[model samples]
Target: MEQARRVEADVDSCDPCLSVSHLSLRFGAGCPSCMAPDAALERNVCPVCGTVHAVRDVSFDVYPGEIVGIVGESGSGKSSLMKCIYFDQDASEGDVRALPFDGGAGNILDLSSQHKRRVRNTVFGMVYQNPYLGLRMDFSSLSNIAEQMIASGERRVDAMCERGYELLGEVNIPARRAKDAPALFSGGMQQRVQIAKALSNNPPILLLDEVTTGLDLSVQASVLDLILRIRRDYGVGMVVVSHDLGVIRMLADRTLVMLDGRVVERGLTDQILEDPQHPYTQQLVYSLI
Candidate 1:
C-alpha cells in the first residue's frame, strides 16, 4: 500500500492561503468503539489504531482556484480527509499551515482557538451532503444567509441585506422568493440556497461533500452546471468528494481514488479514469459503467 507522502517546499516562500506539509490524522480505537454500531462511519477501522488500518498516511496539495475531486467507493476515506482539512476534526499528527488574511502563515493544527475560529469563518466555506441541513428550515432563505454573515460579525444591516439579496440573485433565486423558508423550495432550490450561504463570505476555498446526492438526474445536472459556473466565476479552489465517476468527470480537474480508508491511486481525471494504475481504481471504474 502507498502511504501518503509529503511534497515539501520552502515554508517561508509560498502562498499562504493554502499550504499543507506532512499532514496526517489518526483517530484512536476507543473513539470508534465508543460509538454505537449503528452510528455513521466513513473509514473502516480507526485511523489512530496501531494496527494496520484504513486511510493511512494521505497527503496532497490544493492550489488556489483549482477544483480537485476525491473519488472512491463508500467508506473510502474521502469524507474523512475532507473533514480533516475543513477542521471538523483534529489530525492526531502532522502539520497543516494556511495563510491568513493578516499576511502570516499560521499552523492549522497549532492555531489559537480564536484564530482557528477566524480561519473557518473568514477563509473556508463548506457545503455538506444534505443541503437542508445547511440552512435553517424554520427561517426564511434571506434570514438563513443573513445570519451567516451576522455570525461572522458583519453587523451593518443595510450591507447584509444588500449582500444577501445579491447572493440570492447570483444563485438565480428571484428576489420575490428570497424571504421564503427552505421547506417551501424544491431540493434543487434548497441546494442553490446552500451554495449562496457557503459563498456568503467569499471564502477562497470551498469543501463540498456529496452536495448532489439524492437529486433527480436533471436536477443533478443543473447543480453540477451551477458548481462549474461558480468555480469559473469566482475562481475559488474546491475539494469535491463523490463516489460517482460521472460527477467527477464533469467537475474535477484532478482525481484521487481512496479505498478502505487509503488512497489507492491518483492522477489527472482523464488519466486515472481511462488508464487507472491501481487494481482497486480499475474495479471502481468498471463498476461505474
Candidate 2:
C-alpha cells in the first residue's frame, strides 16, 4: 500500500492512462479473500462471518494505446472491477484515478455525482456484455449517440448528428440506418451501435466487458476486428474483460489473471499463454488449448 501511494503521489514519471490502486469491494466486515483465497473462490462466503469479497485489493494500469485484458472464470471479480471503474457500482475501498478529465489528476472513485456523470461522458467509454445496458432500444441510433453528446454539453445539433453518422459508419453500420431504432437492428448490429455510441464522445479510455460473449463466431470476429482497427487508427487505451482466452489472445497486448478477486498473475498476453506461471492460469490456458 505504501509503495502504491508513493507512485500515486509523484505520478510525474508514471502516466498510466488509467491507474487503479488497491481498489476493493467488500460486502461484509472483513475481506474473505484476504484470509483464504481458495476458500473465498470455492465458496464466495467467508467461513467465519459470510462476508462477500467481490473484489480484493485489485491494482493495475492501462497505458496510452494499450489493450489490457482481464480474464478469469465467472465470479472471479473481473466484472466487479469493471462496474467499479465505470462507477455503476462503488468500491468499498480504494481509488480509481484517471486522466484527460477534471484537469487530469483526480480520483474518479471519489468524485461527486455531477463529476461522475462528467467523467462517464467525457473520460470513459464502456461497452457491456448486454447491449441494452449501453443503448436505448426505443431511440434512433443517431439520437442515442446524440444523447451522450448533449450530456457532455455538445449543443450544436448539426455537428452532433454528423459525428453520430460518422461514428456509425466507422463501426460498420450503414449511415442510412442512423434514423432507425436499435430494436429494429440485429443483435450484432445493436452491439456495433453500442460501440459507435461509446466512441461518440471520443473518450481516451474504453472499457469492454464481454462484448462478444453471445454472438455467433463470425459476428464475434467482426467485432474483434473492428476493435483492432479502432486501436490502430485512433491509438486509444482500452481495458477489455472477457472469460474467453481466444478473445484475450486476440486483443490484449497485456493480460491480468484473476482468481478469488485477486490478480494472481499478469504479463504480456503471449507470454501468459505460452508460459503461465500461476497454477490457476496454467489450468485456464490448458483448457483453452
Residue-pair clashes per prediction, in order, are 4, 0
lDDT tens per residue, model 2, 1-289 = 3433343354335478888998988787765444553453444557677788888889998877788899999999999999999999989988788877754577888889998999999989999999889999999999999999999999999999899989999998888889999999988999899999999888999999999998999999999999999988887889999998899988988899998788999977877888899999999899987
Report the lDDT tens digits of candidate 1 across residue range 1-289.
0111111122123454565554545455545542333333444553343332334567666666567788988767678777777777776555665554454455676877787777777788888888765789879988988888887889998888899899999888999999999899988899889899989999888889998889899999988999999988997878899998889988887788888666778877777777888998888778867
For candidate 2, give the lDDT of residue 17.
84
Runs of candidate 1 with Cα error greater than 4 angstroms are: 1-17, 29-54, 100-104
- The estimated TM-scores of all candidates read 0.83, 0.91
Residue 252 error for model 1, in Å?
0.7
* 10 residues in a row with least lDDT, candidate 1: 1-10
Which residue pairs show collisions in model 2? none
Clashing pairs in 1: 4-57, 16-99, 27-48, 55-261
Candidate 2 lDDT (Cα, 0 to 1) = 0.87
